[model samples]
Structure formats: structure tokens, C-alpha cells
Target: MTDYAFSSVNQLANDFKDAIKNADDDQKKVLKKAQAKFSLIERNYQIITNLYNNNMVDEQRPLYFFPSSQRLVAGKEEKGNAKLIVPFEFVGKKLYYGLTATGTHDLNPMPFNPRYPMVGLHANALNTILDNKLIHEVSKAWVVLIIIILGVVLAFGIPSLSPVQGGATIGGLLIGYTYLCFWLFSSQHIWLDLFGPAITMAVGYLGITIYNYIQEEKNKQFLKESFGTYVSPELIDQMYESGEEPSLGGEEGYHTAFFTDIQSFSAFSEKLSATDLVSLLNEYLTDMTDVLLDNKGTLDKYIGDAIVAFYGAPIEIENHELWACKTAIIMQDNLELLRQKWQSEGDRWPEIVHHMQNRIGINTGQMVTGNMGSASRMNYTMMGDTVNLAARLEASAKQYGIYIQIADTTYQPVKDQIVIRDLDFVRVMGKTEPAQVYELISETGQEPELYKKILPAFHEALALYRNQEWNNAIEAFKASDELEDMFPGRKTNPSRIYIPRCEHYRDNSPGDDWDGAWTLTSK
Candidate 1:
């Protein structure tokens, strides 16, 4: 009997060794497969970690890791040994064992199965069914629906209440929900999906807030780009802060349009080298433009040597027409000073023997003013018949020899403050209705006594010319030209050109229907 027992013990030891060898080989293969699969899952885990770390989904909790020291064992009846234990240090926490006939039969002291109760088969079967039913119910479609509805109501309803009430409502709900979920999970071993709805709410709110912030910044940049040239920087910032965009479209308001160009600039530029001509133009335009800016006029556009600008609109000035007229006079005055300075410095200035003067034309009327052009290219400008008339008057100044001319339409409004001499009534180039052009002689403060005296005589001559007394009008113009410090030396010759033309027309009359208004056939 002792020999038999010893042999049996030896046989058991051999079987155990064989099993260990096979299990180790199987474990290695299983571990290699697990590592490969886990490697793929680990990469996904890293992506999730990075997203969470970046606060991409602020309310979602990060994943938890089970400790590496934990282990799992199998075989319920094996008292002092385990079939397999993973991460062996956690074995002491509590080893879960599955009962089987092999385990009870091999270690012959008839080990008990912890999984079974002493109760009959029906009771065990009933408990298994209950556990399965509970899992199924928890994972049902209705359960997911409930969670979604709860999230929506909380997110929308909380913000609808007063601030303090909303805060209290949300806080109380969050605390109660968290506590309930924790208690259910710990005591009943049931898992609740807390993170999903919370993440949805957080992401939706954050997305809207971020989008609005970006839009606001874009609006600020647009405002700065649009109005920087016309308004002060501080006021621009204030408008941006207040979120008000200035209307850049057309407005119905009175404004003065000033158009000016160098007389015979194209012919003059042909005589000089390109570099010298460009430099000269730059010098002249810079001085003139500075004067325009000083008078609070918007420099609308420049067409080569010509400057087209306006007063009022974009920002309104009460004396817009007055400002425009004042700027033109100042520009003429500045040019005289510039000519003297250039001559003293030994610069080759353009000849003024025949005619070389800036002829400015101003008109006040309704015009469509705004940024006008295609989507890709646009310019802030004023457009209408009034703008065209201003240009036509500028061209007309060359014909009649005047420094500045305003239409009768323009002169009517500011007649109280300005002294003007009616030069001519002509259907200027493109229009059928005759326009009376008047030279802006002086302002109320700087009215020259000589201009005041000769201006009345010139108008009387103009009235006679309109009535077909061409010979008498010529005599009056010649006398006014000779008046001391009246029309000046350079300007007198150009005024003299019109007298010979009038004499020729008078000699060969154009019948009773002729209105005595000269029409320009060509530019």
C-alpha cells in the first residue's frame, strides 16, 4: 500500500510537469496574439488621450487602467494552486475560481464549488435568468433614449431660466445625478452611461462660442481695413468694440465734388524725360494733396495728374460746399508759392507763357457715393451727372481762362459767403441745358477790392454778350484785363483769346435763333 501511494504521487508529479510545459507554450502563443491586438488598441488609446489632453471634449472622463500587478486565476476546487494567474501580485486581493469536475476529482478531498448554493436546481436557474435580464434591459434602446432626452432638457432648459436660478438648477442636477449613478454602480453592480450626454452638451456649447469669437475678430479686421483712411484710429476702435458697421452704401445728402487737372499736362510730359516728369508730378501732387487733406476733404481718386475729390459723406461736415471752394482757392495759392520756390531752386518749371494753371471745377448736387466696382476690384467714389458736370466745368475753365469755376447750380447755395463773376453761359460739351460758369473770386474775409470792382463790369459785359452785343462786351473785357492787379498778367492773355473768337462770330451772324452760347465740338 505504501509503494502504491508513492507511485501514484510520482505519476501525479509527472502529469503536473507535462501540463506546465504545454501551458507555458500555449501561454506564450496567446500572449503574442494578445500583444499584437493590444498594440492596435493602444494606438487608439493614445489618440483618445491626446484629444482629451487638448480639451477637445472637456466633460468626457479619460480612460482608467487596471494595475499591471493584478492577476486572474481559474479552477474553483484547486485550494492551494491556480491553473492560470495573470499579473500575480493581485492574487491576494481575491482569486475568482470556476468549479469543474476535473478540479474536484484530481485533488480527492472533494473540494466544494463556491459558485453553487445548497438550494435546488430551479433556484440557481432562476438567478441566472434574472442576471441576464438585467444586462439586456440596461443595454436596451429605451435606456439610450432616456439619456439623450435628459441631456437635451438640461442643456436647453437651464439657460432659459434667470442666471441665478439656472446656476442652481444645473448644479443641483449634476450633484444628484452623479451620486445616483455612483450608488447604483457600487451597490448593484450596474453601469450607467454618464459621460456620453455630458460630452455632447459640452461640445455643442463650446463649438458655438468658438465660432462667434472667430466671427467677431473677422468683423473687427474688416472695419479697420474699410474706414482707417477716413476716420481717426481711436474712433475706429470704438466702433469695432461697439460692433457697429458704418454704412458704406449710397446716401442722399448734399456734397461738393471738386475735379481738377493740370492744363496741357499730356503735352508738357512729352517734352521731359520720364524720370524728371514723374518727379515733377510727384512734387506738385504732394503739395496739392496736402492742402486738400488739410481742408478735411476726402481724396476720392487721382486720374494721372488730375485729382477728383469731395467734401462730406462717409462723414458729414455742415459746410461741405464752402470747404470745397476754400480748398480749391488754397490749392491755387499754394501753387503760386510752389512756383516761386521751384524757380529760386533752379528747377526747370513748365512754361506759363500761353497757359499753365490748375483749373478746378466744383458742383454741389445729388450723387451716388460708395464703394463701386466688381467683387474682385472696387473703388470708393461718387457717381452721377453732378460729378460729370464738375469734370465738364473743369474742361470749360480752359476754354474761358479761369483758375476755378463753379456752376450756377453750385454757386446758388453758397452765394452769401463767396464773391463770383459770371463768366459765360454754355451748353458744356455733353448737355443740352446751358450752365452758367462763374469764377470763385474770393471768400468773405479775403475779398480783393480790385476783383470786387472789375467783377461787376465783367458781369455787365457778360450780360451784353448774351444779348448779342459782342463788340461792346469785348471792349469791356479788355478794360477789365488792363485794370491794375485785377485779372493779373499771365491770366489776361488767355482771357484775350476769347475776344477774337467772339468778334469773328459777331461778323458772321448765326441768325435770330442763336443763343450766343458757344458749344465745344471736340475735347
Candidate 2:
């Protein structure tokens, strides 16, 4: 019976060898045959052990076909079709090994065919065995650690930097990490993964950069829409550079207030069609407004035929009063050019349109300047007594037959830079305190030849009128008017307007306490 049992076991082993040789490259078939043969050997372990112990050559030979057996003398129980050994590729060859666990490492070959143990296996399989869960867990932990560190850095750091700086920082991190991984691998033979951490940082950088780009564009659009029509491009650029929004609340500051209106605009409105009126008004406004913006003035709003603007708010100008004075003269000069252009158009415009005139008033004082109105609707504008006086001056220019009127405050700071004439010392309709008003004639050295001829007699006439010498004042006024008439095509001189005033005062004299300050009853 023992002989028969030995024959059965030997026959089974021979059949397993035959199956492995016949299976060739079929690893699953070889594994199936090995399982069957190993199962029988497990059942008959005492018989095989006794044969091998008795020094029989065939039985004593090592069964290298069996996988490593630190758990048992033979195959481990693979219940539910779970494999105890696994197949892996090595050096372009297929081989099998016992599955790796926490503390087990066996690199010795496990042959598919017992006749040739080295045929289907490689010596490099030892390195493959070492590439196990332990190494993978360490690599994965390293990757996670790298990702966490870089994520924290990029989240906090990238936003503070500009686009170019952020990009360069990302580049430096990637290059530095790549070099670290390569150095570890080359110098220490550590297999730290490059692809995982590299991809994570790259994705993080791209996401942050895109988000910053979108937010920057949003801020830029907001600035453009908010201040585009009110402030100059240069001020808008300054706001963008500062990365701050203008305050919506009112602020009190020293500013120069400006107001302008077309002279006899009501007559033009009566004469022209609505479309032609709008066209003409738009052309005039565009030309005048360009000078204001060019000199860094903030436009407040238009009131029919009037333009209201200011300087030294939202952004401060170095010499805002001076700038306002310069802009007024430039606008008048531009109006003259437009008049010439309209005249050459050959009566497409009316004769009155060709002779279009406007009045400008400027004052410098403390005022409230900011976005004003309800929450849902607002206008960036100016208010206070200064602004009111500026409007009053604009309305009162018609009385003096003048084109440009400026308060004494506006004239004092820029008096050396511009040519101006003292028009009057008067209290406008709304105010209690009287202000000295002046006519802004031209920039220094740019006054007309006619001003040179009439100004001497005009100055004498003004002094006599202030002295209350009505008779001499009337004669001096007429002389100045005659001098103005010498220059043909001149507008009605201020001298001519004062003549009747002198006549009236001569007839009904002001009291002895009269301070030579006229009180205007109308705006």
C-alpha cells in the first residue's frame, strides 16, 4: 500500500511537470496544475517526507517549483480562489512570486518548469520584489506631503504676487522639486515620484493664475464703467494702479469749480430743429470738454446748454486753479476755430451759429465733492457755496458783456501765469459777502492787440467809476468804448455797459457809505 501511495504521488508530480512543459507561456495553466499537485502533496506529506529523508535522489531533490513556504511546508490555503502567489513581468519575461506582506522578502527564483529554474525568471526580480507595498506607501506619503506643502504655499503666496512673479515662482518650485527628486534618485537611489507632485503643482498654479486673471479683469471693468465718463483717463489709470475705488461718500476739499453756458442758447433752440440743435450742441460740448479733460478736470454733468466741471477731486492736481484758467482760454480759442470752420461751411449753419459764443466762470474754494444722490442713483458732482457762486458768475457774465469770468480767488494763485482784467467788486444774487470778479483774457504774452489799445482807457474809466465821479467816468467809458470800436468786429465792450450805469448813478447818487461794491439784483 505504501509503494502504491508513493507511485501515486510520483505520478502526480510527473504529470505536473508535463503540464508545465506543455503549458509553455500559459501561466494560468501552469498555476492550475501546480495547485492540484500541491494539494495531493499536502494530503500525503508524511509519505513524501519519509522518502526524501531516506536519501532517495529523486525525492531529495529540491522542489524549487514550490513557492516560498515560511507559513507551511507546502502550498498555503488559497480559499475562495484567492491567489497566494502572483505573476509579474521582469526583464521581458514572466515569473511568479509569493505575494508580498509587511515583513517578508524572498527573491529566490520560483520555476514554472522544474527542469529549468532560471529559464522564465530574472536575477533582477530581487529588485522587483523590493518594489512592494512598503515602498509604494512611502512614495505615496511623500507625494501627499509634497502636495500639502506646495498647496499651502501657493494658496497664500500666489495671490500677493503679480502674474509674472507668480508664474516665475511656480516655475522655480517645479524646477526645484524636479531637481530634488532627481538628486534623491541619483545620489540616494530613493524612488521619489516626479510625475505626481509635478502635476499637482502645475494644476495648482494654472488654477490660481486663471482665477487672478479673471478677478483683475473684473476690477478693471468696474473702474472703467464707474469713472469712464466723469474723470480723465490719467486719473482712471491712477485709480487702477492704486487698486482702490473712489469713496462714494462726500469729502470736503479745496477745489476749483467751473461752469460754462452758450450765450443766447435759447435763440438757437428756437431757430433750429431738434436734431440740428442736438448736433450743434454736441459738437460744441465735445470740443469744450476735450480741453477740460486734457487739463485733468473731472466733469460733473451737463445742464442743457451748460457744462459743469471741477478740478482737484478724486485725484489732486498740482495747480488746479491755474489749470482751470488755462482750460477756459483753450476752450475759447477752440470755439473760435470752430466758428471759423462753421463760417467756411457756407451758410449750412445760420449766421448766428457761425458767431456762436459761450461764457465760462471759475472759482476756487472749499466744497463737498463726491458721488452724491440716492443709493440706486448717484452722480459724481460738487456742491456748496463755491459751486453756487460759480454758477452765478456764469449767469452774470451776460451783464458785463464778457466771455470768461473768474473770482479773485481763482485769479490770485495763477495771476502771474495768465492775463486778466478786474471786472468788478460785487455781491452776486445769493451771497452776503461780495467777491472781486475778473475777466480771464489770455495766457501770458498771448493777449490780443485790441486789448492793448483799449485797456488803458478802460482802466482809467474803472478807477473813475469806483471813485463815484460819474461825469468823468462817463467820458472815460465813452473813450474806452471808442477805442474798442477802433478794432472792427469786436464784441460789445465792458466799457459800453458801464456808460449807462454811470449815467444812472449820476442821476440817483449812492449814499456816502457806498463802498464801490455793486450789488447785483439778478443772476
Candidate 3:
């Protein structure tokens, strides 16, 4: 069969009518053949009209049609139309019997199904418009709300999950929301924003996930550079996992500050060769630094021949003062062993190097800790009066001929756990207020009870000294010196410094307004 357009079909119909009117046998035979061919094609391929015609009563539906030669195009608006015009696109394109793959221009019916290519699409559109069943999209407010909900839900959920799980979550949400879109359109003729929500969910998930990964990587690098040298890898991991950043600002915190410096280090360095000094210093520092970090101390810095550190920073340790005291004791114990090791390696340096001792100072109080330095170089460190006192205490340790000294704030926390001696309340240079400093002896306060009698006498002497009774204080201090029979560990005698001061005070009595606080003229 041949394809036909609305114009060609009209021309053929006219030819048949006029040829018969002219009365010619050959023409009649040609017309008869054309009519038979048209009939045969119509019987085989013509589709039933899908539109409810205005000419027919609404209750009386036509189930079948007798194909008419004049009605070539099923897309005609009416049976009584006088105008012969049609869309140019449909001029040569064949009208389908019922949407066949053989031809094009099948817009008559919807594209979802292959039926009624002539009248189905038009009838469907007309029916939708007529019945008020046109799908109306959800409001802009609803769309925005849905986007936000999906974006928030996926953004939060994705980062907390593994990559595979996050992908799966996005996929499931997209599919589920799309299904809801289809269901709403079918059931209630609603057109929700399926594409919008799906895209928002996927985009939000990926954006948040990637951002978190990058931030985590950045934090790993930062934490490594900031603390990698001193703290253990495990501690680093703990800090990193906590997800707290150490930024450039200070905050008040209760922490224990620690400082240490070798005694006569300048004199010892003078004797050692440059190479030997560096080698010895490296070894000494490595061992001591490990002990400090093991006790959860953040190594603030190394000053020439000293180590400065603190506990309860970057990460808080509950018993920071106790840790500081224990770390001091540990450092002393470790240093003794190291000295023995150096002695065994004879000729490494002067024999006097084996007797090297480090003085330690610790204090506990409210201090400021964070990144502090010039714009070019920032140091994650601590500052405040508490920190200053700890440094001063380190210097004062040498004055008392002792290894370690801590302020009263530190002593109160570890008195039960450590053996200590009450030193004195003295005003260091640069400060107006007097602070009580004590010497830390050992972890165990229970021992030979060697300083028991001397401690009581020393307290009495200190009390007398504080009362401006210089003669009585000197007498009490001398009795204390006589009572101490045990070998002094770090100091030659605890009462020596106090007695000299008491003798001087007795020789020249002070005027009124003496708070009994000795002020050191030097740092």
C-alpha cells in the first residue's frame, strides 16, 4: 500500500468524482482500480477514531467504523469542515493505522503507547484538559522544603559512613524519591520535584564527604608537624581522633608547668669538644624527652641546656601536677642511670661529666597555653605568672642546692604520693608577691624517716623566722641541722641557706613592715 497525506487524499477523492462525471471508460476503469486499492488498504490498516464526536450522542458510542475515502486524515477537527488546510509536517508523512513502525508523524496519540495514532493523542489531551486532571506541580515552598530536607539528611548521614555505604545511601534515597514522584503523579495527578531533590541529595552527599576528607587530611598533617617529635604515636593518634584543633589563641586552663636545666652546664660545655658536646646532648635530651612525653608532658621547647614543658594541654590530663612530680622523679632516676652509662664509656669526656645533674621546677595553676609568637613564627606554648614561677623555681633549685622545686600549688596535690621538704616562701626578682616553694625528694614519703626530726625543727625555725625572731630562728635552724644525720641527697644541708639569712637578720634587725619574705636580688 502507498502512504497518503491529507492533501493527496483530497485530490484523489476529487479525481474519482470528476472522472465519473466526464464519462470515459478508461478513466472509469482507472477510478475503479483506485477505489478497490483504497478499500483494500483501509480494511487492512485503518485505525478506529478515538475522539467522541460532537455529532454523536454522548450515550451512544461507536465501536466500529466503515472506512470512508474522503476521511484520509484522522486528525481533522470536524466532519463538516470546509477548510482543507493541514500541518505541513503531516503532508508527506503517513498517518498510522494504530501507530505502526512503518511510518512517522504519530503525534496523534501519546508516545507512551502505540495506539490510535490518528485520534488517540489529541483525544487524551482534550480529555485531560476537559476533566481537570492535568498534573499540577507541587508549590515552590514544598520543593524548597524537600530540597533542604534531602540535602540536610544526606549531608549529615554521608560523612559519618564509609564511602561505599554513603554511595548506597544516596542511591537508595534517589530511587525512593523518584518512586514517590511517580506514585504521586499517578494517584493524585501531582508533579513533585523528583529531579531537584535527587540532584540535591547526591550533590550534598559528595560535597560534604569530600570536604570532610580534605579537612581530616589537613588535621593529620598539622598534628604531625606540631607534636610528632615529642609525643608517642599513640598519643598523636588519640589527639587526632579527638578532632580538636590547636589554633593561634590562648585560653586559661589548670595545668602543671615544668622546667629543667643542667647544673654548671656552661662550665661543662667549655671542656667538651664541639662534636662530643652535641653527641652527649643529643643522647641526654632524647632519653629525658622520652620520659617527659611518657608522662604526658608537651615539650614546649629546649632552651640551650634546658627543657621546658607542661601537662594538661592540647589534651587534658586529670592529675597533671602529680604527673609533673612523677616525671621529675623519673627524670632524676633516668639521669642517674645515664651518668653510670657514660662513666662506663670512659674517656668519652671528662670524668666530671658523669656527675652532671639537672635542676627541675614544677608549678600548678591557671595558665594560658596556645600558639604564641611573632607573625612569622608561631609557637604552640604556654605563658602567665604560673609558667614564670616554674622557670624561677628551676633557678631557685640551685640556690637551695636541690634538684627539684615546685610551688605550694603543686605540692598540695602530690604531698601524699611524694616525699618532699618545705623549702621557703621567697620573692623572686620581678615579682612583688611571695610564693612558697618546696623540694621534691622521692615518690615514697615513707622511708628511713631520716628527715622526720629535722623537718619539724625546720618548720619551727621557719615559723620563728617569719615572726621576726631571728635569734630564736637561727637557734632552731642550727638544732635542725644537728638533727639531720642522714646523707643529704642533692643539697649539702637544708638549713644552711636559712641559717645564714637568720644570722644576718639577727645582726641587723629589720624595721617595721617586714612581711618576713626574703626577696632574691637575682634570678
Candidate 4:
């Protein structure tokens, strides 16, 4: 049995041959007769263990061939079959066998693979025994402890960080925890199940990240639809992320209102086809609206050729009245440029194109502004006396033959910032109180030298006309008439407007309490 315990089957066969060579001629003759049977049975038994990939029975020794236990003491080739054991390539010392494990999945064999499937597990078991590194598996209570510790800490920590910071935090925690598990396994032969806690943190943070992404997209879409046409996209995005989301309700605050209308727009539309009308209006509105939005005005709604807008609501603005007045001034400048461009088109447009004009009005006062309407639909707009006053003033601009008009309140704060001339004190329809209206002369206070020379005489004429000095007022107004050419694109002049009024008042004057304010009879 001892002589047969060799590494390879060929080595054992050589030992068997040596034993037969030492036999006498008579014993060799008997051995040679039974050699074929012995070789077949031994090879068949060895092949059985490798076929199943496991050891089911201990190998038997050839004791019956020796005939007695006392004869087994002698060194002979006495074995039923030599047991095969898998070991390391260089290991020649101790070997492990019959390793036991519970509830393990079967080693699934793959085709075309030359190595046995169970070889890895066998090597691991053998290594554990050799290195004294068998794992002491963690208990149910230990796994639960890990879950509670990590879950409670991460729950409070993740939401306080931004998405990138939160992701980094979660990644760091998982890597650190895995390191701890590996450390315990190497140092103390302890194995911990990281799957439960790893899954908990992953699901928690991933859910939060997904929810935040959805909310951010919602905010961006809301801002784009609500304010894209009225302001810069960057401003809208910053306003949304500022954490003060605007809703339906409003706060009480002083604000400025603005209104504008194109003169004879309906008559212009009658001369053009629908497609041509839309193209012309699109270019005209885009130019005027760019000026309005550039000055930071919130566009309300368009009524035909008219636009209604306001400032200083939803978010407070500094000097909003001046912003409103400046936008009105810019509207006229852009309107003039468009008129020149259209005039150059000549026969490409209708005869009405030569007379393109716009009138604007601005007023400043306290008003309610918000998203106002039914529950199903609402519009962000202003309502109250200030809004109506601005609209009335714009409508009344045509009566005074001026392009831009603003209430006294709008002019007060912006007095030094803009060029303006007093138009008249007029009692607008539907109101008992009369407002002092001014014509917004220019965006910048800079004026032509010709205008500066004519304005002094006009102011003198206006003072005399108000005081009922008809003859002197007529002479002063006539002296200013030569400067009318400086105010281009108009068939009428200020002196021409007031000379008839002064004549009518002079002939019919007997009233004692007239305040000299014009009472407008129509819009």
C-alpha cells in the first residue's frame, strides 16, 4: 500500500513492474497470467472518482493478494486502487480532503472548458485550511446594525447637498464601507454582507436625484412659457432658481402702466393681402416690442394693433416709472426707423405706408397686479385707475397730434432724464379730475439746436394764450412757425393748433372760473 501511494499512475505502474522483476521465475509466471485483469480493474476504479468530480469512497488496499495483515507489514505493491488528490503545483507537505459546505449552488459545467468547475471551490477550501483564513460569517443582528447606522446617517445628509455633491457623498460611503468589510475579512477572518446596506443607500439617493431632476425641468418649462417673450432667457432662468416662485396672488405696490397703438392700422390692412399684412405686422411689432422688453417691461396682451404692458409687479423694480417713460420714447424712435424703411419700399407697399405712426402713454400709481381670471385660466395683468389712465392717455394722443404722452406723475421722477414738452391739462372721459399730460420729446435729453431756439417762443406763446392775451400770443406763435420744418413728418404745428383756439376763446370769453384745461370729448 505504501509503495503504491505515488503521484502519477505511471509512477505506480513502474513500482509494480519493479516488484514483478524481483519475483522468482515461478512467481513471475503466475503474476504474468493475471496482470491484464489487475491493470483493468485498477484503472477503472481511478477513472470513477474523476468522472463524478467528487470523492465518494476511500480507496481499498490489495490486502487479499497478500493473504494476511502480518504480511501487509512487508513492503509490497499491495493496493486495490491508489486515491487521487488535487494539490498546489509546488506543495509537497500537508493536503486537505473532503471539505464540507452547506447550501452551495452546483458548479455548473461549461462546454469547451478543459478545467473542472469545482476546482476553484476546492482550491479556496484548501487555502482556507492552510492559511487559517476560514470566514466567521456575520450574524443577522450585525447586518441589521449596519443597515440602521448607514441609513439614518445618509438620510439626514444627502438632501442637504446638491446633486453632484450628494452623488459624491454616496459613492464615498459605499467605497469606504467595502474597504471596512475587506479589512475585517483579512485581519480577523470576519465576513460581512454589504449587499443589504449598499442597496439601501443606492436606492435612497438615486430616488432623490431623479425627483430633483424632474422638479428642475418643471421650473424651467414654467419660466420659459410665462416670460420668454417679455425678458431675456437668462433672467427668466435666474428668477426661477432664486427660490421665490411667483404664483397667482399679488402684493400691494406702486407700479407704472403703459399702452400703445398704431394709427390707421385697420386702413393699412385693407390694402394688403392677408399674408402680406401678417409679414408687415410681424416686422413692425418685433421692432417695437424689442424696445419695450429691452427696457425691462412686462408685456401684457395685444389688442389688434395696440399693446398693453406694465412694470413693477411680481418683482419690484427701482425707478419703474422712468423705465415706462423711456420705453415709450424708444417706441417712437423705432417707429420712425420702420417708417423710413417702409417708405423706401415705395410701390412695394400701399400709399398708407408713408404715414405709419404710433402713439404711446405712460402713468405711475398704486394698482393691483397679478395673474387674474377664473380658476381654469388666468392672465398676468394690472387693474385699477392707473391702468385705465395710461390707456386713456394713449387714445387721447391722437387728439393732441403727438406721438407720445405721459401723465405728470410719470414725468416727475424722470424729469431730468428725458426731453419732454407740456402738451396740455386735459380732463379725460370717465374722470372728473384732469391730468397734466406731456409729450415725450426724446429718449435722451439731447435736442437739436433748432428745437432749442423754437421752444422758448412756444413757451412764451403758451403762457400768453393761457392768460387770454390773444394778440400777443398770436404774434409769438407765428414767430415760432418757421421752426416747424425741424419737426419732420408732420403736416401740423403747435402754433397752428393753438392759434384757432386762442381766437375762439378771445371772441367768446366772459367766463370767470375757467381753469384753461382742455376737456376732451372723444377717445
Candidate No. with top lDDT: 2
Tens digits of per-residue lDDT, candidate 1, 1-523, equal 1132434534644544554456667775654444344444544566557656766545443232356443444443223223332232242353333333444432223135534422334454566576663422256465568567766765677545654675566567667767866777767767766665455445644554465568778886776687555434554566676655435655656788899998778776777778877887888888888887777777787899999888775566677888888888899888888767766655465444123468899988888777777878877788888898899888778666677989887788788998887777678778888777788877876877777777776667667666778888788767766652533323443246557756977897767898667766643
Report every candidate's CA lDDT: 0.67, 0.80, 0.78, 0.76
Give lDDT: candidate 4, residue 172.
95
lDDT for each residue of candidate 4 in 360-434, tens digit (9 for 90 to 100): 889999888877888888887788998899999998887766778899999899888887777787899888899
Best of the two (3, 4) by TM-score: 4
| Model 1 lDDT at residue 167 | 50
From the highest lDDT down, the ranking of the candidates is 2, 3, 4, 1
lDDT of 2 by residue, 186-221 (tens): 666577888887887899999988887798788877
Which is the leading candidate under TM-score? 2
Model 3 lDDT per residue over 1-523, tens place? 1354446755776766776677578777766666656644543332222112323234333323367435334333332222222233243454433543445566344356544455555666767987899989899899999888877777666777878888888888888988999999999999997777887987787788788789888888778878887655666777888766555688788999999988889877789988988998889899999999888889889998899999888777788899999899889899999989998998877866888889999999999988888889888899999999899999878777778898999999777888778888799878899998888877775534766676778888888988988888888988888876533234556677888998888787776787667788887
| Per-prediction TM-score | 0.53, 0.69, 0.61, 0.65
Error of 4 at 513 (Å): 7.0
Clashing pairs in 4: 62-79
Clashing pairs in 2: none
The stretch of ten residues in a row with the least summed lDDT in candidate 4 is 81-90
